[model samples]
Every structure is written in C-alpha cells, then in structure tokens.
Target chain A: MSKEFIKGNEAIAEAAVRAGCRFFAGYPITPQNDIPEYLSKRLFEVGGNFIQGESEVASVNMVFGVAATGIRSMTSSSGPGLALKAEGISNLAGARVPSVVVNVARGGPAIGTILTAQQDYLSATKAPAPGGFKCFVLAPATVQEAADLVYEAFDIADKYRTPVYVLADGMTGNMMEVVELPPMRELSELPSKDDWRVNKLEQDGNFRSISSYSPTAEGLQEMNEASEAMYQQWDKEEQRWEAFMMDDAEYVVTGYGSSGRIAKSAVKELRAQGIKAGLIRPITLVPFPKDAFDQIDYGRIKEIFVAEMSIPAQYADDVRWATKSKLEIISVLTSGGVILETEAIVDAVKERV
Target chain B: MEKSLLIAGFGGQGIMLIGKMLGFAASKAGMNATFYPSYGAEQRGGTANCTVIIGDDEIGSPVSRRLDTLIAMNEPSFVRFVDRMKKGGVVIVNSSLVQSKVEDKDVKAFYIPANDLAQELGSVQVANIIVLGAYIAATGILDAEFAKQVIAEQLGRKPEMLELNMQAFDKGMAAVK
Candidate 1:
C-alpha cells in the first residue's frame, strides 16, 4: 500500500511483470512508445524477454512466435500500427494462440494524428479474419483501471485461448497517477503447455506438429466449429459492465476510456447544477454486454447519447440490435487528436436531458 | 486525495525545473508524486509546462483540471489557466513574464520577481528555484528543509552539474527569505 508516482504507460510495463508475463514484443509509436521503452529495460532486470521488432508487421509475427511457446506475451501500438498487425492477428486467431495486445488508440482513417480516438472498436473486435473470429476487448477509463485491466488481459487471453486487448488512448496512456502495484507475494505464473510445441516427443510415436494449414477437411470443419462454440461460451461467461446513477435516471450516457473519464467528471459538475445523468461502461467488448440494455426501460428515460472519441456512429449497428424499449439514441462523436473535454459532455448532457 | 499543479513557461524560465524539484521533494517525503515535462517542440522556442501531482491517497487522474495550486511562468499561461483555477486557489505569477493582476480578489495571487531574484543570485537560470521558494513560502505545502533533501538526492544523479544546480537552488530559496 505504499505510495508511488507513475504514468499510465509505465504502469502497464509493471503490470506485465506482475501478471507473470515473460515476453514482450512491440515497436515504438507515439502515445504508446513509453510502454515498450519501459519494458525494454525492465525485461532484462526481471529475466524476461523484450524485443523491439523492426516494424509493426515484424512485431505482430514476433507476438505469434513468442505466444506459440505457451508464454504470456504482449505488444502495443496505435491505429496504423494496429492495421499492420491485423493480417498477422488473423493468423493468431486461426492458430488459437493467446496474446494480449494493447492499443493506446490514436485518431485516423489514415495516420490522422498521434492523439486518440475510440474508432478502433469496429476494427479490433470485428477484425476481418478469414472466417471472422472475435477478439476480447477491454476499455479502461481510469489510470488504476488501465493498470489493473492489463494484468487481467493476460489471464483472460490464456483462459479463453484468444487474443485480449486493452484499448486505452493517448490521454489515458500518457496520464500520470500513483499506481498501487500488486503485492509481490500475489504473483502467479501463467500455465505453460507442450501441445503447441512442434516435432518434439519424450516417448515413442509421440511427436506432434503445428501448422496453419489443416491436413484434413473434417479437421478444418471441426476446428472452425470448436472456435464458434468457444466464442459463444465467452459471450456468456465473460462480459463486464458498470452502470452508475442509472437507477431512476432519465438520461443515460455511454462512454469508454478517456471519454468515460470526462463523462464522470461532467456528471459530477452537472449534478452540482442538478442534472440527472447516468453512465453504462462496457469493460468487455468482444461479448458486448448487450443484455444490460434489456434492463433499461427507455420508456422512462428520455435519451441515450453514445459519446466516444471516434464516430459514435460505429456502435449504431449494435444499438439497433437492442431489444429497445422506445427511446432516442443520439451520438456525440469526434475524431482526430484532441481529448473529449468534460465541458463538452456536460453540454451534450444538458441538451439531451 | 491527490492534488496536481502544472507550471508552464518557456524553457529558460524554470517552470519545468521547479515542477521536477517539487515532485522530487514530495517523493523524498514518502508521498506519492509524479512530474512530467512537456518537451519536444514546446521546449524548442514557445511555452513549456511540467505537470506535477502529489497525493496522500491513490490518484485516479494524473492530469490537472482545477488546480489546487499553480505557477504560470508566462503571460499566456497565466491568462490561460487563471480562469480554470478553483476559486481561492493560490497562483504564483512570475512578474518578469506577466505584469498583470488577477481581475478577481477571491483567488490569492502572489507576484514574485523570480527573474530579478535569479539576477540577484547572479544565476538567471535559477528563476525556477526562486518561484519554487516563493510557492513554498506562500503555500507551505512542502517544507524548505525537505526541499534541500530533494536537491541532494535529485542533483546527486547528475554529477557534472550537481554543485552549480544546488548552489542555484540555495540562492533561489534564500532570495524568498
């Protein structure tokens, strides 16, 4: 419980150590450069491996190589870098390797700026793999949440045998705060297995091989079926969300990461002036907490404004899937570099309420 | 609860240095603290700022909103952050850069001629230290003795500039006295 000052990005490095992560592979990029920089030195001190790969493409492949060894591995990058990793990421899914990728999201359609945007939601969770596989995504709002969720990411990825991503942004990643590091005694190493090993055996007729190609049609069918079932199970078992001031509220504002921070602050100042605004934050995005929407009686509430750093329009498709009890859903979206200010949220809430 | 301050000015004006030394002192006193300097282009010619947060409890947001305390190293920073401060917040202005007064009497404003003090000490780069001394003298958030300890620990890291930096810090602190 001792006090220490730390920035959000460096705390991810410390959390990686606490989470028993032994391998880190990443390239330097704005907003998230601190993560790799801190790990490059600390990995050596902790007897772990850190590789600043040549490019984002190389870093993604490196993630595949390291995680194949059944180690807890990770990589971080921004929007463009993430795009380069997407092709390799599909392979990771096809191979069923567990890796945690952190994206300190930045604005873009193409290299927009080194600032931040939540527009990556559609790109990440709905990554355009061959057959369409889903990746679990967690959005952290506070520096504490940012640090703690990173540790959670590694555990969840291994447990689900899927990629887990912590989608923070430049503001959240760069913000400074005191990190309450997990106790050293609480450290637990992630489980490692030999099944992913190639061409090795201790007994007669026991050699095994791993490949991206399926040797049999039936084998491919069975694997795809299994992947779907696993994803469905994740949908049921692993969804997290927080609803604050939702009880007896007329307006609900939904946001994540930096936008969520601004939302909370706006709510506080608005409450001081007597406006009732609530928040619903989805900590897990792969298995989006779609059910929580059912619990909301939009018949009573006047509106739901989706405020995000990216186009709030991205979530439009999902919002339509809501078993919606009649209510107007508005979007407060912005893009390119600047943080979504608390004043903006308050103004938006005032207009909606 | 954690409170944060952002001291902004040009590179040679000493805002970043003061912010770092304050954070160093807070850390030495066993308090949670962080100091971040905004470098790169901001350090090249225009304005520069360092954000510092000190806390007793775990801090949530490291960035400042309504600062509990502030030191505006330049006129633009003073004009920019003045209205953003909480009412009754203590703001130490470097009169060398900003000669104007706060329009309101609610906020406590201290005009310290840090550049003049640095000249008196025959060390103009020590303006940051002078501002720190004035901030400490007015707010008393950190003890002066604790600052000396901070100077010792932080300066020890850079062996080449240790003696001169500490001397500058001492002279700056004495000027406020």
Candidate 2:
C-alpha cells in the first residue's frame, strides 16, 4: 500500500469507511470537524448514509439506531460535544451495540477551548457515562496509528458487542502525516448480524428486541453480570502499550495520545543527554496497559514521569495505580489548549535524572 | 537526518498550502513527514502558520519547539518565528513584504522578493511556490523533481494554472541558485 500524507481526522474517517462502516451521524466541532466533514462526502460516495444530526446527542443516538440494525456505524465530537453524546454512548453500551464513537478530545473542564488537550482521559476510560459499563478505549499517538486503530475499532467493537472509543486529541486530528491505509473490508466478509439485528426479522424471524433497559432488576442484574464478564475478558486480553528505549531504562515516562507522542521525543533527547529515560505509551487506554509498568527495573530506576496535557493530571492516576505508588512520580503537564513541548519534558526529566 | 521548518504569513497567502506541499513531497520521496497547521480563530484575518517536519526516523511530535528552518512570508511572521529557530537555522524571508532583516550571524538567510517573482510570473498566489522552490534549492533535503510532481498532482484540476505554477517553481529554484 502506498503511503499518503493525510490528516489524522481524514485518515480515521477513511479507515472507518474501509472497515465497512455504512453510517455516520455527527455534529460540527472544532479540531474534530474534519472527521465528519470528510465523511459527509466520502460516506455517500461509498453508498453509505451520512447525517449531520441536529445535535451531538441526536447524532450519537442516530449511530445507536444504525448499529441496532447490525450496520457498522460511527459518530465523532470533541470534549463538549462528547459530553452531550454521553447518554447515547451509554445506551449503545447498555444495548451491546457494536459501534465506534470517536472523541477527538480538546481542552476542557467544560467548553474550555478549541485547542488540543488530554483532559478527557478519565471521562473516556473511567466514566464514559453513568453506567458501570466501559467503552474499550484506543488512544492513538500518530496519524498512522489513528487510521490503524480506527480500522481495528470496528472489529473490536463487533467481537465484543460493545462500543469502542477512539480517543484522539486535536493535535493528532489536525496534523497531517504519511500513512499506509488499510485495505477496504469486503461487505460480504463483514460479520453477519442476522440473528441479532432487529431489522432482519423478515429474514431470520427472530424479532430481536434491542434496548438499553431490561425491565426487571433480576434481568438487569443478569445483563450487568454479562457486561462484567465481557469487560473482564477485554481487560485480560486487550491491554496494549509500547515500551520505547526501555531496555535498560532507569527513568520511565508514561503518557498516551499526543502527550505520549511528545514524550517519545523527550525520551530520545533524555537518552542523548546520558539519561536512561524510556516511555510507556499506552495504545489501549481503557484496558489501561497497567502491566507495562511491571517492565520497569524498580531496583535501579530513578523515577517515573507522568506527562499529559491535562492539569491536575488525570492520566497520572492510572500510572500511580499501575506502579502502586512505589516510586516517586513526577507529572509534566500543560493545560487549556497549551501544547506540551518536548524540550520542557526533557528539562523536567533532567531535574530528576 | 531530520529537518523541521515553519511557513508563516497572514491568512489567504497560501501559507498552509506551502507546508502541505513540502510534506506531500517528502512523503512521496519515501520519507516521514508531519504537517501541523495553527488552525481555528487564528485563521480569521490573523497570522496563519504551519510546521512541517521531514525525517528518516519516525517523526514523534507533530510540532518542533526549535525549528531548523523558517519561511516567513511577511514581516510579522519573520518577527514571530525567527527567535524560535535553532541557531544556524536556514531562513527564507519574503523581502517584498518583510522590511526586517535577519541579523543572526549563525543563520543562513535568503532574502527573496517572492511577491515580486510571483508578479513576474503573473500571479501573487504562486509566491508560496516560489518560497517552496527556494526551500528545496537551499535545503536539498528533498529532490526538486519530487516537489514538481506533487505540485502537478495538487494543481491537476486547474490545467491553465499548472503551467504558471511550473514556471513559478522554476523561477523560485533559479532565484536560490
């Protein structure tokens, strides 16, 4: 496959189309607007449906509706918009709808800025909604990874019968890079949903009922237990991370998405400066890659740096939990649309190393 | 080897296109490249800029804090980004719009009247291509032929414009030489 220089949002959108996604419903938002903007025309050209929903909430619900028919579907938004779509996302999880929801995250506690940030770490991985269910989160640090992960997300979602979240940031969404796109999935090769899809009643005569509600407490308990079981399976099998220059690393840096990407350069600079610094970039954020921390030589390592674009450091909590707070953890942070500089990260590591 | 450059100017000066062309050319030449634009409210009559990084290694960050090259299309762009450049960096200033001069002794500076060159070519819009041509000739990081190929593909829809752009590219290369 020939690589082409394309923006992350466009790559993701194209990947989704290649992955057999026949439907997309989304509202406009900065940073991530390109995803839907690309899809608006791209999807239609593939004979797929593209709807610019009245609102983010409506868009997500529309995705939920499309997914119920056993069609691979998606919706995308930034921070504020993601918040609006939370209820629909929770509904998708509850109904076990295999769909992809992309959160091209931007700065915010609430409508903070249109610039990039990693503030949605907790919201995406921890509490996507009021439900006890979790969306399998894939955080991509590069445009190539963004396309690859989004291409994989549809399959991951179908396999588990759950919503998969591609947690990208504004930087990744806006930046253009050379990427080798995945080959298009044959529609015939796509998994059959005849037995489960509601719209297939004429063919299967199953008369399937898909709803987030189970009616009775006992039924709900059974549903929750089933969800719990699936989650356990995901946690056991899906934790993915990248260990960069960790062969003899005495200083470890942990981050995901854009933060992780920036930290990688920082790791290189630190290594150049005679510091054995390494980075653990989590490719999967929900199943949190906690075991990557185990690779650290705790006996010789100096410290751990938790870098993120969020102030008060939401991602650091996972790093702390993963390492069990055994070593001193330093946080390298920037907030409210400010980008994390590789030089600053190197400087921060220099202080400790 | 890795090279990072920034192209800055006011909106509508084709600032973003310059970065995209460089990135696409690098990619076509089988190298890794990242093009990150300063998007959003800044595009509304404000200064528009984009950073392009080309390297053999996997490019990590989309942006570089210390740029190896700076292509400033106007005075403000030169003023804003020159200091962020690494020492001994290559700077291509559009002398037609920029009154300020590069004072850094370590920096390899090229003062090109890109607008004037574009006027000679009959369109000021091709001024960016002129700068891009100078960048190629100055850096030699990428083959000039690859850039011409990318421009042909990018401007393929406008056949009449393609001939002018090709001449503009040649004019730019000659100016640097």
DockQ of each: 0.32, 0.84
- Give per-residue CA lDDT, model 1, range A1-353, as digits (tens): 76455677988878877787778888888879999999998878777899989998899899888787777789899888888888777777777788888999888877877766677878877763456777778888766788889988888888767788788887777756555766441334446565554434735667665445598999988878888998888778887887877887677777767777667666656777888777777777777878767778767876777777785466545654653635676777777765566677678878755
**CA RMSD of each candidate after superposition:** 3.5, 1.5
Weakest 10 consecutive residues of candidate 2 chain A by summed lDDT? A199-208
After superposing candidate 1, which stretches have Cα over 4 Å from the reference? Answer: A128-130, A184-189, A199-206, A216-218, A312-325, B1-4, B12-43, B50-69, B136-152, B158-177
**lDDT of candidate 2 over A60-140, digit per residue (tens):** 999998899999999999999999999999999999999999999999989899999999999999998897789999999
lDDT of 2 at A265: 91
Going through the candidates in order, what fraction of the true interface contacts does each contain? 0.19, 0.79
The DockQ score of candidate 1 comes to: 0.32
Once superposed on the true structure, which residue ranges of model 2 sit more than 4 Å away at CA? A202-206, B43-45
